[model samples]
Target: MRTLITIVAFLSFGLLSEIQAQEKHEILSPQEFCDKMKSDDVQIIDVRTPKEYKNGHIKNSTLINFFDDDFKEQLSKLPEDKKILVYCRSGNRSGKASEILENLGYKNIYDLKGGMLLWEKAKTDCY
Candidate 1:
């Protein structure tokens, strides 16, 4: 019974820690994200497949396929010091990628709220 209680407590702590880490990197709206891209010296990362990115993506975004097995290895080429702005076709993948970057201790991470689709839909005269 004591062992069971300890295991449960450990699991709860681990889960809570993961949740807190994710919360530290919150997703931002498309407009807010675009504003940063325009004014700040930010690294725009497109976390989509190469094929998808080739079709269409935000201007000046570096293509980094999140599904690739060597995704983190590829990410190593990017400067750790730059502010990273990330997005996907939709919100799902970029959100996960942002969390991964956060876990890797990368500061200044921003995720596009509804991703590229929303950005294009908003069509707010942004690239």
Candidate 2:
């Protein structure tokens, strides 16, 4: 009974930690994303393909293809202390990338709510 109690306590702690970690990640609208971009500590990441990126992307954003085999490896190189803003063509890829970032222990990750599609629809300027 003592061992069972200890196991339950340990499992509860683990679950609480996971929830706290997930809370650090957020989904932001285009306007909110733009506002955050003004901060010098924010690092913008475009997770689209090279060809898609060539069509257009946010100004001064870094290109990190989501489909590339080195996607996670590349993300691992980012400074964990800085705020990371990630987006893709639509919301799907960026959503997945944000999960990866969160799992990698990024404390301040922001994913664009609707990606470039909504960004453009909202008349947010792109490069």
lDDT of each: 0.85, 0.90
Candidate 2 TM-score over all chains jointly: 0.80
- Residue lDDT tens for model 1, 1-127: 9999999999999999997866756588887887888856689999999898988999889999999998987776777878899999888999888878877778888899999788888866575
Per candidate, the number of residue pairs that clash is: 0, 0
Could you tell me every candidate's TM-score relative to the true structure? 0.78, 0.80
lDDT of 2 by residue, 1-127 (tens): 9999999999999999998765767899998899889898989999999999999899889999999999999999999878999999888999999889888888789999989998988855433
* Highest TM-score model number: 2
Candidate 1 positional error at 93, Å: 0.8
Clashing pairs in 1: none
What 10-residue stretch in candidate 2 is worst by lDDT? 118-127
- Cα deviation of 86 in candidate 1 (Å)? 0.4
Q: Which stretches of candidate 2 lie over 4 Å from their true place?
A: 1-21, 124-127
